[model samples]
Target: MHRLVLLAVDVALIVMSTLLAIVLCGPQSPLPAIANIGLYPLITIGVAIPVLWIFGLNRTVWRFTSLNDCWLVLAAAVWIVVFSIAGNFAFDGVQGIPGSLPVMQGLLILCMLVGVRAAMRLRHSVRRRGRMARALFRDERENVLLVGLNPIADLFLRCAAENAREHIHIAGILSNAERHHGRSLRSCKILGPPEAAEEVLHELSVHGIRIDRIVLAMPHAHLSRSAQEALAEIERTGAIRVDQLSAQYGLSELMFDSAARVRVAGSEPSVIAASPLSSGELPASSYLRWKRLIDATTAGIGIVCLVPLMLIIGAIVLLDVGYPLIFWQQRPGALGRPIRVLKFRTMRRARDRSGRNLTDAERVSKVGKLLRRLRLDELPQVYNVLLGHMSLVGPRPLLPVDQPSFSAARLRLRPGLTGWAQINGGRHLSAEDKAALDLWYIRNASFALDMLILLNTAKTVLFGERIDHRAIEEAWRDLRS
Candidate 1:
């Protein structure tokens, strides 16, 4: 039900934004002959919405949406402008469309969409205020003990306080002694350390105060053995339900630009092993619905927009290299099954004297080389995603024969067009680095991480940034050494 409502909001924003863009671009409407331009608004919405998904905008709850999210929307808008201009220049074949129109359209569309979200935020703020005030006025406020104060939970509490809404009034902060006992953080006194959590809870309950949710807001570092043990003890009391703040808001220490240290006594730090075959892990099918929905939507749109370009490329490949313009090869699919992956043939059909195929770098033709460099070759795999054999973002699929130990470990899930490995090291990554990244992704795959990787992929491609091939290889070598 929550997802359905969110999806509805997403579709609404796309349509509203596109219509608003058209209106902001010029007169009440385009000239009758060019009134076909009105359809462009829908087209723009079609493009923008998927781009928003690619950027993982909807992953964020409205209350927690931040400036960084807005930047992503703005960047997606910019991409829409570029893709629109490029598509027009290459094909559209029509004249008299406003030169500045698309850019203006993108800006206005983004502003409107952002405005709608902002308006929701304002409403939320007012409602929270009303609730807080009501709680205070009715003397119905509970002595609320907030456990963690991470950014997201902080924002919610702040909203409540600012509005004076009738809700659980904050009594104090409950955290580890090292973090809050000796320090001043946002006016809330740290009443007791996590080690003293039970004593504190008992004291509150005995004093006729009721404890609600224990909002877990510690950084990833703070989620160490000591913290977990303390939290475990807290949980045993059956006095509070632990609402994990970091996981809910996607707020980790890495998300912050600043650095902070976590002190863990007598514990050795180790990297998460990179492998698809991790034990006791959930099946990738758990997210299959999300994967398929995104794939179908993205690929459907991509194929429509790229049909003309595909036609031209198809012609060039046919004339230059004869038959079989599309290349398909067997690669590992989800759970190590075999699937035929598709790409535009960038290599010739030449074989060795033994009748074996030549290596990729060797058989790769001039046009193919250009296509590979620009990533036009992989355009066809969008279909693979649509067909459910692949995903827009996950661990990049590897050839069955080249299967490294880690892929077998990681192939517990489906392969993706772009993933943690692709963004971090790409073609430059070593098996070990790829494994680590893939495993990390498997452990932490979410709507937002996928979006971040997709955005990063765009940045890498557009700027011609060298994939950190050296770093990847070195990481492998270091592991072996």
Candidate 2:
């Protein structure tokens, strides 16, 4: 039902925006071209509907949708207009059609795509402010049957409690394995496991209860092929939807694999599980699709816009540090994986007695110091953002040695170039302090918070507020003691 709602909303918005764009900006000397033509809007919309879906815009949930998603649609619109115009110019030699048509077309596309979305967001914001904040129940609370009672399951349960406002009620827990049958979980009684799935579903459905969704709390590390297949078969019954909640958020396997809730051979194959707590949560596909679209668009534009500045910086770094101006290091990435981190080297070469190395401050060259002061050293990480290895905002990645202890916390998220810590305390923070900020970010990360952080980062960097290094030293010393 939620999926259907999203689809309807997306289609309506897309069509309306397309029509508005044409009416407002379509090529015409005195009157709008779109108002005169009856079929052009329809044709453009028809063509754009598939493009939007292919770009995964409609696939996004309206609630958790971000500006990045809007940016993606905008980029796709630009591509559509640019390519069409270029083809017209190249093949048709641009003699017949007015140049204003392409310009108006591009403008109309951008305005409609962005403006309608903005209006929808305003409506959502107003609704949220007026509402008492609760998820709408369908007849009754969602009848959820959880398969495991492990720590990950517990976390999911906690998520359920937090989002109970969303109306998910645990029907009970089940464990087909003999070892788990007798165990108790809080208020939930442990029924039998996989073998007893049918009997349990029967009893629940008979008593005015509907098993809306089945939850698998099996951690990725402990999942087996047969168990997975069994769950798949159960979901295939169409009687209920199946979801998996696992602790493999940072597992390298996912890097090479698709999301947990992917369709395989026309079936909604279990890929990644929805957060047991995220009832009506935005799908992962929404984020992946929008993030890629935004990253590509932003990076392309940023590179073009910042070309002169980047060149100037490159020349400075080369002259000041000699050759190999860019500093690239392997850093732990999303899901505890590895990716190359790029920055303008902010340090000079300085070796210790063993010829091994020196600390950050000691190695930092004079030019590097100036770069660090301006935070210009980090501009290169925009490429990491472009490559999808990082986000413009997220938990900052850690060096491998710096990551293992906080693996669980960091694994819960994708690493970012600038994050809560960067905006809050940045270089002035101790490891523990940084962790606290990261955890805080993990706890309250939202589109609004990210925007606030981005704004603060700009302020802090442009103002050149030197970090309270003294405070960081004191915090580090206290932690050591």
Candidate 3:
């Protein structure tokens, strides 16, 4: 019912904006003659409604509308303008409508759509601020001490800043970097290094500032030994409870919800799970069934829509790399099962004197580089997804040699074309970092998180920001300490 209302509103707004644009651009007052207008305004609205639908604007939550959402709206508006102009030229020609009408309609429609959504967001924000003020005055919010000042930590602080009704109030930050000692994040001062957590707690206590919880916001793989020790020490003290914010928590809190509910914690150091999954054990959840359904649907649609492109890419690969256009590798899939993953061959079949394969840089062809840059090489994996050996979103399957580095929990799920780790840092992350991300996904598998991963994956692929193996290895070595 609400969607129906929103759809109607969208259609009405598009039509009204088109009419207004026509009037504003007209030399004569009011609307132009019936002959002059012809189907111009009608055609403009017609193009706009479908374009907006394609962009899923009517279904977007206005209160949570973001820059990405606005971009989609802008894209839709541009499409509407281009299509309408072509439509006018084809149907009415220059004599039928003014040249500036379509341009004016596009700008007006874009402003109306984005402006309305922004207004909705502003209203929600104001209401949330009021609630937050009440909560702050009553001292009812949980005082949280954020540990780590990484991207995840920065995201958390951003959420707190944007939403006033958030249940967690960032009291201070504890970072491992010495340069961040006196810096502040979103008005919260960096208290000290993680090693000085206890001292900071005592000082805060002395100053009558009580911290209800200590949240470890860094990636598990990135947590240093000292930071882990600090978490253990803080947990043992029991003065303030400790919570390790996983990818699930961070994403949910930052993107979907203003307040993320705390997961149940066992009476142990929060750094390590009490009963980590071992080999042969899979975490059971209904969400996995939903995830599989999503994987199948998306992969099926993708294969159908991209068949022509796939054929073209296959031809290009064949010409560039010869014969076998598709390369197959035996990767460890769900539950340590061997699965043949398919991809467009991006490298030549070159070997060294010992018959071992040459380095990737030596064998990679120009066409392969372009295919990889656009991530078109992975299109063949749609078959793997359909065959049920993989998912659209999950941990990247590891080679047998790399399996030991990842936890059993990560291996329990089906491998993916793109995963949490891939979107977060992609090939740049270390084995441990990837393992940590995969473990987080395994524990918090949900339809929402899967969608978020897919969205981020699109952004990552579109921007061509994938890091090289040498850089990844260097980062791993540098951060391993």
Q: For each candidate, what is the lDDT?
A: 0.66, 0.63, 0.76
Which pairs of residues collide in candidate 3? none
* Runs with alpha carbons beyond 4 Å of true place in candidate 1: 1-72, 144-165, 174-182, 191-481
Task: State which candidate has the highest TM-score.
Answer: 3
Query: Over the stretch 1-481, how does candidate 2's per-residue lDDT look in tens digits?
Result: 7655655655565556555555555456434554454444445554555456545666665454587887777766765565454444444454434445556666766676666667777787667544424444234457798886566667667767644525677888876457867576766768777557777788877886778888777643344566666667778876788775553343233332234431122221121111221122322333544555665677656754665687689899888866677788998776557888888876666776679878877777788888888888888887677657888777788776665333455445667767877876776766656765565555456667777878888888887444544544543343233
Give the clash count for each candidate: 17, 12, 0
* Candidate 2: segments with Cα more than 4 A from true spot: 1-292, 350-363, 464-481
Residue 320, candidate 2: C-alpha displacement in angstroms: 0.3
Count residue pairs with overlapping backbones in model 2: 12
Best first by TM-score, ranked: 3, 1, 2
Candidate 1 per-residue lDDT, tens place, 320-360, comes to 66578888899988877888888888777789668997887
Among all windows of 10 consecutive residues in model 1, the one with the lowest summed lDDT is 267-276
Predicted candidate 3 versus true structure: per-residue lDDT over 383-410, tens digit per residue:
7896689998888987776754334567
**CA RMSD of all predictions:** 15.0, 17.7, 18.8
